[model samples]
Target chain A: MKIAIKLAYRNLLGAGLRTWLNVVVLSFTFVVIIWMKGIMVGWDYQAKTDTSNWQIGGGQYWHQQYDPFDPFTFSESHAQIPETFNENIANGDLEPSLIVAGNIYPQGRMQSIAIIGINPKQNVLLLPTQKLDTFINAIPAIIGLSTAKNLKLKKGDFTTIRWRDSKGMFDASEICIVDLFSCNVPAVEAGKIYIPLAVLQKMTGMENEATILTFRKNKMDQQKVDDWVLKTNEDLTKSIDEMIKTKTFGQSVFYGILLLLSMLAIYDTQVLSIFRRQKEIGTYIALGYTRTQVIGLFTVEGAMYSILAALVSAVYGIPFLMWQAKVGWTLPVDASEFGMAMAQTLYPVYSALLVISTVLFVVLITTVVSYWPSRKIGKMNPTEALRGKIQ
Target chain B: MENHSIIQIQNLTKIFPMGKSDFTALNNVTLAFQQGEFAGLIGPSGSGKTTLLNIIGSLDTPTKGTVEILGHSIGNLSAKQAANLRKEKLGFIFQSYNLLAVHTVYENVEFPLLLLKLNATLRKKMILEALEWVGLTDKVDSKPPQLSGGECQRVAIARAMVKKPVMVLADEPTANLDAANSHHILQTMLKLNQELKTTFLFATHDEKVINYLKRRIYLIDGKIDKDILVDH
Candidate 1:
């Protein structure tokens, strides 16, 4: 095998431009695939991080009737705060929020929204809830950039919000938008408004009651609380995982096409090598190689392209990928429009396993493709090959 | 000197398929070669001398009878055994100066020694010595395409002689060379055979090569028409 490798290396180098061209094409495939995969992984990592900071804190305990997808459940998904969490809540290690489905009228246009009440002093979530602490003639509130855009309301703008209280009686109040924050998480940004927890609880006639509890990351010793469902960070991020999985599967088709083109080039080169270098193959046999060894030599010769490509990729790919990871790949279009928790700029993440496995896969496939055409050598007559006869 | 015989052939025949009938490439031939004997199969183009050489070199098997090369029967040897025999004890030179075109002249000469798994220092020494024998020591780094016909043939000679095999087989080796290159290469082979006591066998119709042969076995239509021994 050592001798074979030596001879194959010499042969490939001797072949000159033809060999390098193949290496360049294969190397391009490696870089592109690895880079694309890295972007996807980086997006997954970024999306989950943003979601954790902007919305789900470390984890959440949802009231038994709290179905985020069903707005009707918000009316009943509340009860008096669990006394067990009072101390942590007071220490601000955990924050309790109440959700009430309501309608907002801005310039005579009514839009349904989720009116969420959060502690203005909570430090776990990356929200501008502190702005709710401002004293104003009207109720102080904050909205996401998307919601502010939809309502055509900016900071300091006043809008009337109407909702039903605990007894199903309708009530209305005016709120002054204290802030409009931007975030990557769509669930936290779209059609959502935040007001001081005490204010919303009082207005809804549900004081001292909460619909969900969000704890600081790694700060709480969690227990099974009655009438609530425990959701860990991993559980909260499952939707992102599922979405990324679908994207990966879809991208695999493009990956397959790219890989196929590169493999076909190698396969064609191997077959052509056999055709054009028949005399060399026969000379090898004449020099004392068995047909099997000649086949092995050809296969090794083809597989070396992948190794060369990897080295070549490392040459230019490392610097390019590093720069990309630092600056990130900014999507030309708005990613939030995709209706997912995706950032506008996504950093590519490359792991050792991703690079190693990709290289191995190409090498393995190239070896098989190279060996496929070389099998014809085993049935050849060496004497004819020596004469450069096509057999 | 009664040197041990390196090759023994008995009533050997080779048949090839052509259309619906079989073509007799070698018909009922018999011959033997001794170590240190510089001999040639002297014949016309279709007299089956090259076919007989191929059988003796273990590149081909006989259809009938047997050819024993260095104590191994050519008709019974497996592909691997034949290859091993060729690698360890046999050398072949083709008509077109079959030097690996992409390889440097030194690499071409070093090829057989590599197959023998010789150490690098030893392989380099033998390759240099062989190239020296062919007066190609200065052309080590030149590829075949860069070398003239005469130089390429010399590189081929260096390759065939590098391992100092028990027998060196030449199949019309001078067919592609001019008269000048032909004699130059033949003289190199004769000197190696005499100095190393290695057997030399040539299948040729070239008078230049035949003039250098100590024994000439003339072939006519795959049979030995005349076998003559000449005193030097």
Candidate 2:
């Protein structure tokens, strides 16, 4: 078997220029898929971690009132939180929530910012164990650096929360920024002012009500969570219901376009790779190689190219993606409405499984595409092939 | 079934289809060549001479009639069986010296021997002897493209005989060569025929090739026009 391979490989190497061109094309395609996938995955992770878009507790929950005339109510009929939710929560399988509220602050110019309410003890425990000061034990709130700069409030300085009540009544209250901290989320970078959730609820006059729940662990089945959230919001006010539906559709459409474009790039590269090897292939078949051998030979060759390309992509793609995950890639000012809705800065997520799957899928597609031309070469009449002929 | 005859053909016909019409390339041709005989197939272009030689060489199947070579009927053999038969019993030297361009002279001579599953030591010995017989022993590592026309044809002849097949088919073997180169190839082929007792079959339009044959068969329009056994 090795000897046979050695022979085939030698013949493959005879056309050095063609082989190199194939490798480059394959590698380029591989890089494109990986890079694009990294961007998409990055955007998704950033969106999920935004603390506003996706709820933090593995997932989110919402409730609706029974009628439009009724005041906003959290009713079980609107959405049912699985009974297993608390069990998973207590067992550390669920992530702790970071309650976040958004409002506009006016200085010389008006700037929008987010206020995150954190229980220092619970927040520290839920986050990845790190050396940051415990927020629960400290009285002063920890605000993100960017958020502090934007609001012109620093550590030991006082800021105020202002908002319209449910009756359209205006209200305002002064709060103090105790510390400055930053998280991986880009949205948090610009607009976060962390304080005690209890304090914010009182100041906003919501008493014991929580605005949102956030978590690091995404243990909830995405489909189940999405369905429950949608069902719960179905009976909400028309405006609120429309908001959720529009958000979901908008994200899906953006992601779909990204996937379609990546596939087209991969396909184009593979076609070019195969087209360049026509003469080399005819030579192999003329050497008494069966069609099966020819197919196997080229398929393996195509796979090698994909693997090389994927490896190159992954080496740079994974780390680059991870770095972007830690920080983020910000979109331009002229961004689409959907991009604006996602985050100012988009971070990429790294999944080993997704990378592996991408590599395998690219290889499979390349092999499949290479087969048509390879089989055409394989089935060529030996006489014509031996005559140094190709069409 | 003469003791000396290595191949015999009887009433062989080959029909080829060309663009909605059928043409008979070889029609009702019959002849025989003995072992060690240096014979030539002489005809004009498309006289069915190459077609008859291809059938005898086991490279093509006859549309009708039987071709008996080395006591096996060519018609009854499977494709694989015919390929094996060609490998073992027949050798071919084409006009263009159809040597695989990528392989060296020695590797080309050793090719048919590889198909026989011979050990490397014996294969090397036989290949060296075949190359030596053609006076190409010093050019072992050179590829076909580097060789002169005569040397290339010599390598082709060496390849055909390295397996020690019973008969060799020469399809216009000197067609691509100059006068000196053509004479050198013909003489080398004749020397191998004499020394190895291998039968030689030639399909050629060259009068020079006809002059060297002990017997000549003239073909015209897919029919055997004449067969003259010249007194050698």
Candidate 3:
């Protein structure tokens, strides 16, 4: 095996431009594949981190009647705050939030929205909840950037909000948007507004009641309470995992096409080598190499292209990838428009597993493709091959 | 088989499938070669000289005969065993100088010893000595394409002689060289044969090669017409 490697290296190096051309192509494939995969991995990391900071603080407890996908359940998903979690809430480790279905009229254009009531001093979420503490003539509210954009509402703008109390009585009130905060999580920012918990309780006639309780820590070891369901961090991030999985599947098609192009070059080179180097193959047999050993030499020769490509890629790719990881690859368009957890600039993260697996995958594929064409030597008559006759 | 013969052939026949009919290359030819004997099979094209050489080199199998080289029957040897026999005790030189084009003269010559799995130091020493024998030590770093036809053939000779095999087979070795280069190549082989006592066999109609043989076997229509021993 060592001798085969040595010979393969010498042969490839001595082939001059033909060998380097294939190596360059394969090296390009290596860099691009790793960069693209790094982006996906980076996106996954970014999405999870943003979601944890901006919306789901570690974990949450939802009322059993609450179905976030079903707005009609918002009317009944509220209950009085349980006494067990009040101590944690006082310590700022737990935050209670109330939800109610409402409609806002901005400049006479009505937009249906979810009115969420959070503690004015809550620190579990990165939302500007302190903005809800303003004392003004009208009810103070903090809206997300997307909500403000859709409704054409800005800070210091007064809008009419209409909703029903727990008794099904409809009421209307003027609300002032004191702040508009930007966030990567669309679910937290789109068509949602925040108000003080006490103000919302007083307006809805549902005092000390909340539709969900969010905690600062990730653990869910608390005993089950009636009418509340625990959602762990893993469960909360499941949707993001599914989204990334779908994106990765789509990206794999691109990865496969790239790999196929590189492999096609190698396959072409192997086939051409077998055809052009018939005398060399025959000479190997004449020099006492069995046909199987000749095939092995050719396979090793082909597989060495990947190793060379990796080294070449490292020459340029490492710097490029490192720059990308630090400065990040910015998408041409706004990423938040995709309507999921995504930042404007995604910093790529490359793991050791990614690099090693990529190299191994290319090497394994190159060896197989090389061995495929070299098998023809076994059927060749060495005497005819010595004459450089095509078989 | 003769006890003193390094190569023994008995009623050797080789046939190829030409379309739907059999084409005979060698027909019922019997011959024996003693150790250190420099012999040549003189023939025209299609006279089965190369066919016989191929069989002796274990590159081809016989149809209806046995050929024993170094006590191993060529027809019955498996692929690996034949390769091992060649690796251990045989060398081949071709008319077209089938040196690996991408390798330097040194690398091409070192190839056979590499198969024998010799250590690097010994391989280097043997390679340098073989190149010196072929007068190619000065061109060791030059690839086959960079060398002249004569230089290429000399490199092939060095490669064949690198392992110091028991027998060396040359099939039309001087067919591509000029009279000057041909005589130079034949003289080198003659000196190596006399000094090393390696059995040398040639399959050629080249008069330059024929003139250097100690024994000449003439072949016509796949049969030995004359086997004459010449006192040189």
CAPRI rating of model 2: acceptable
Worst 10 residues of 1 chain B by lDDT: B1-10
* i-RMS for every candidate: 0.8, 4.6, 0.7
> In angstroms, what RMSD does candidate 2 have relative to the true structure?
8.0
Per-residue accuracy of model 1 over B90-140 as CA lDDT, tens digit each: 888888888887889999998999899999999999999999899988899
Residue-level lDDT of model 1, residues A73-122, one tens digit each, is 99999999999999999889999999999999998789999999999999
Ranking by DockQ: 3, 1, 2
Which clashing pairs does model 2 show? A42-A348, A42-A349, A56-A214, A56-A215, A120-A135, A120-A136, A121-A136
Candidate 2 displacement at residue A166 in angstroms = 12
For model 1, the docking class works out as: medium
Report, for every candidate in turn, its global Cα lDDT versus the true structure: 0.91, 0.62, 0.92
Estimated TM-score for each candidate: 0.97, 0.68, 0.99
Candidate 3 — what's its lDDT? 0.92
DockQ of each: 0.80, 0.24, 0.87
Model 2 over residues A258-312: C-alpha lDDT tens digits? 4445445444544553454444343333222344655666656545556556655
Output the worst ten-in-a-row residue range by lDDT, candidate 2 chain A.
Answer: A68-77
